[model samples]
Target: MTQPIRVLIVDDEPLARARLKELLSEESDMAVIGECRDGNEAIDAIGRQRPDLVLLDVQMPEPDGFGVLRAVSREYQPAVIFVTAHRDFAVQAFEANALDYLLKPFDQERFRLSLSRVRERRRTGATELDAELVERLESLSSRLTPASERYATRLVAKVGWRMRFLRVEDIDYLEAEGNYVCVHQGKQSFLTRETMNAVEEKLDPRDFVRIHRSLIVRLDRVEEVEPLAPGEMVLTLRDGTKLTSGRSYRARLQRALDLPS
Candidate 1:
């Protein structure tokens, strides 16, 4: 008989933690060794229990899932499966070399698939996470923390064959194209792998605001907001480039401008 896969669950939400526990309970090969309500608790639990696998929430009150992982990596390391609601951070999760990511509201089939990978990694003795991967994961995790109170001052993007860093303030606007985001700055546009939602969250709200689901404009660059139709508005930039603002975001645009809604 094979040994049961000892698992630890870490999440801030009681309901989310309960749901995962309930699902894992159905698996005879998996056993819940411990549960943590926050990242700090998770670190202590990981140290004490030394579970084989950890189902961790990416967002938490403090020390977050990544912080907990970093703490574990330093000492009691375990295979990790990130549970997140945001799809935009998939690349960052992969860069961390996480066994798998289970998106929020995930179905049982997907959950089972992630567990399969974890089991395979364990059986093959193929898990070999390096220092470089950990550093990159930590950097990306810090950049994605919404409440960190630090705006992205610079962005790394590819230009032709070379990569360059662009100052955030120099960006005029951002447009979501398919899975990529086109960052406009001084008549030049750069394509980035970052989602518009992720980039928008990193920007200071006072300087950048989302005017449409696919568009974010720099407030300082806006010349005027002109009515394009009955409910739509067109934002004219100081450089005379026009970007359309969706009707649903009119109130948000007004609020950003400190104008009456």
Candidate 2:
């Protein structure tokens, strides 16, 4: 008789934790050891319970999911499956060699797939955290901003045969290209593989504003805001680029610019 895999669910939202619990309950070879609502509790639970696996959420208040991982003593480290709603962290999750990266609203099939990986690792007694994975997590954690607290200050992208790191402040504006975003800085534009909505999450709301469904601009770069048709406006950038604001986004633009709506 094999020992059932002990699991811990760490998420701030009760509904999210409950949903994970409900999914895990159906797994015959998995046992729910505990649930934590914040990073502090998660650290304590990981130290005390030593669960075989942890389904962790990336975004929480202060001392977020990454903070929990950082505080845990390496001796008690367990396999991790990062369950996040943001796709921006997927690359880091894979780089950290997480057991799996389960995006939010994932189906039962995806849940089962992650579970199966855990089972296989347990059966082979290969659940210990590797040095490379530990290094990657620490490195990436230092770069990730806790959800709703801060935003990314830089972006990493692959271009042709080389990689590029662009400073967020250097970017003048953003344009949505289907599922990709084109980050324009000066005369160069780099394509990043993320939706406009996802790209928006990585930018500081105070520094950036969305004027259109397909456009986001640095607030400080705006030269003028001109009224167009009813519920419409046009933004002129310092570089003489003109972009129209979406009717639905007009109110936000007005409020941001302190202009009459």
Candidate 3:
């Protein structure tokens, strides 16, 4: 007979762990081998138990989910299903056939779907950690932060010799430059050290849109849109700052303007 999939549930909250446990109790092909409340315990449990699957919570006090992965990545590689309350900016990673992520407040249907993915992975006999999974884990490290559904109202940026808090509504657009993002405010620009994905996720999608690979614009600040060609265009902001939109994001720009595709 096929052995049941050994599972280890890890979460800081008792109810969160219990909720997963309760769900797992009903599944016939799964077995709960252990549980951990923090990253430290999780690391120890993972090493000692060597679970087939880990439903890991991303946020913890000292050692986070990323930390747990770093500690045991070399010697142990288990199929992981991350539990995150924060919205995913690592959509690319998830779409890359990496392990998986289970967002907070996941329903029974979603839970089963994640499990099915695991089953499919095991069925295919491709359980070893690969480059795609490594990329996914690295992506998570950059975007992982405390959970908040509220959009960012302001941003802290570094000026010549001081730091400044700039209001989000006042900013006209954002430009990506390697590791830093330039926040344009009327005539002044402030630079902040952050990834584009990290900054974009904090902004309200209704107010901002990624018009180009390296640019994000405030919707209301846009004054004009001119089509340069099929799947290409130019945008004029209220301040007369014209920026071109990328071909890949033309559809999104159109949707922001309520234009038919």
Candidate 4:
């Protein structure tokens, strides 16, 4: 008989950790070796226990899931299965070369699929994993966490040597101003050193949409989207703010509205 695969479960949420442990216990071929409630504990447990597999949660207070991975010594690294609640990070997670990602509230079949992949890797020999791939995965994992969360919920900007935290939600729109990005909220405007593209990626897609190469607007704040002459379009916000839609983004705006055009 083959040796059972050893597994460790890591998550800050008690119920989530308990549910995963219960699910793994149901598998005859897998054994639950340990459980951890935070990334720091996960790092310590993984180094001490050296489980063959780890079911890791992406979001946790301090030293999050990615931090745990970073702390793992290359000689004792285990196959990782990332568990996340938000879909926004899926693309980035895959790009990190994660063995698999199981969205929260996963079913038995999905868990089985992830297990199968781990088994295949174990059978093939863990040494076969490319070193470059591991490094790239580490890099991508570090980048996967939203910048806003990494830095601060709000950003501090320097206006003539004065710095202040601008609440992210208060911003009406983001605009590219030369090398800097201008943030407008109510009657206040501030010039931030961050680029528009970087800011766009960090903002929640559901709340903010890029209307033009240089502009991103808050969706809930938008009051109306009007078709302009020929191929052009314009959007009006609840604050009576108006922004023009670029040709490239017209289809996206239409899809959001469920409009035929």
Candidate 5:
């Protein structure tokens, strides 16, 4: 019989680790070798245990999920299934790069789907990490500025055959357009194929705030905020443009503006 797939679970949350351990217990084809609570323990476990797969958390303390990959690339490259509670561009980055991930609070069906994908890849003899995988992870991790802890001050977008660089401060607001984001700056607008949450990760939270699920505006550009109704507000921009805040995002908008929550 084939050996059970050796797995390592790494997450800070006790409940998260327990849930994963519980789920893995039902899978006869997989075996739990160890569990880690932080990046340091994970790094050591990955090096010492040499598991076949690692369920990693992106929001862990220093040497985060990406850092763990970087540190292990030179020695071992285990199949990774990111188990993250992170609500940011990182999730989209992983998806866009074709990496498997299980967002937090995921249902059992979703969890099974992720495991199935990993199993399929292993069956196809494609379990090894390739150069492209490393590059993809690097592309997302490169945005992290440890010195400043901010992602980026400028964004590079594709415009037809040309590339455009838009500084974060120059942007008035961003709108979600299906699988893309339309960035408006004064009279010009540029479109990029990225999720709003992903784009939000590239911005400074103090400088920008999401007013709606579909909208993110520069805090300085907001001229006036008017209450429309319960859990709704209309914001007028400095350029006379008006946008309404989403009910779900009302509390966040209020907190961003230091209003009574």
Candidate 6:
């Protein structure tokens, strides 16, 4: 007889895990080998258990689902089916080339479809991570969390094994750093893997303005705006730090600040 497919379920919520377990139990060719409560535990389980498939939750404390993927050794990584509560992440999840992205409250039919895809991939012996999938997942790092229609009032960031929460009001400015965005608050800055555009979309436009391609400044933090040559301008924050506004962004900045030209 062929061996059953080994599967590991990872989710922070007990009910979520239980639900997945119940759904997966109906599959005769799949076996639940292990389960994890969070990203760190998932990483260890993935490395040690070496399951054939992983049902990973997108939102978790600190490391989260993406963090677990990043932490796992390439050789130990398995085919992933991302289970998210929000449909907003569907685009990014599929872009990462996951076997399937299941939105929360999915019925048994949907669950079976996801499992079927994994089974088909296994039969085809296509399980290796490719360059395009890696790049897409890397791009999805920051957008995974804060996937809601409501504006974000706080931000979640990972520092080592711990997760830090920063209120939107506490942020003084934001800077784009590669795949990450540096969240600048009083006397400190924390990095999150989300892109500037993603975070910007979550922020209230009335409270922040993008003065440069890489910069977003809190409106209340602006101390002065000095015009440079032609369309260029310099923005001085309350803390005395200066940021140059892109020539193309000058008019938008002016409109945001309501400055008469």
lDDT of 6 by residue, 172-208 (tens): 9999999789999989999976778777866888889
lDDT of 4 by residue, 1-261 (tens): 999999999999999988898888888989999989876578768978989899989787645676566557766778888888866555554422337778888898988888888888888776333445445544565577665565324544558745566876887888999978898888889987667776775576766778889998877778887898766688888888889989888887777656677
In the range 1-261, model 5's lDDT, one tens digit per residue, is 989989999999999999999999999899999999987578778978998889998767654676567557454677888876644434554432225777788888978887887787678766465557556545564564354554456665668766577888799999999978999999999997667887886688888999888899999999999987778999999999999998888988998888776
lDDT (10s digit) by residue, model 1, range 1-261: 999999999988899999999999889999999889986678768877889899999877555676566555444567888888877656654523336678898999988888888787788775554556556655766676654345567665667656577788899999999978899998799887667776775688989999999999999999987776666788889999988899998888889988665
TM-score per model over all chains:
0.52, 0.51, 0.52, 0.51, 0.51, 0.62
RMSD of each: 14.1, 14.6, 11.8, 11.9, 14.6, 6.5
lDDT of each: 0.79, 0.79, 0.80, 0.75, 0.78, 0.80
Q: Write down the lDDT that model 3 would get.
A: 0.80
After aligning candidate 4 to the native by TM-score, how far in Å is the CA of 140 from where it should be? Answer: 7.5
C-alpha positional error of residue 215 in candidate 4 after TM-score superposition, expressed in Å: 39
Off by over 4 Å in 6: 1-16, 26-110, 125-148
Which segments of model 3 are wrong by more than 4 Å? 89-93, 96-98, 133-261
Instruction: Please report the TM-score between candidate 3 and the true structure.
Output: 0.52
Candidate 1 deviant stretches above 4 angstroms:
73-75, 91-98, 130-140, 147-261
The alpha-carbon deviation from the true structure for residue 21 of candidate 5, after best TM-score superposition, in angstroms, is 0.6
Colliding pairs, model 5: 89-198
User: Which lDDT value does model 6 have at 71?
Assistant: 61
Collision pairs in model 1 = none
Which stretches in model 2 have alpha-carbon errors above 4 Å? 91-98, 130-261
**Which candidate leads the pack in TM-score?**
6
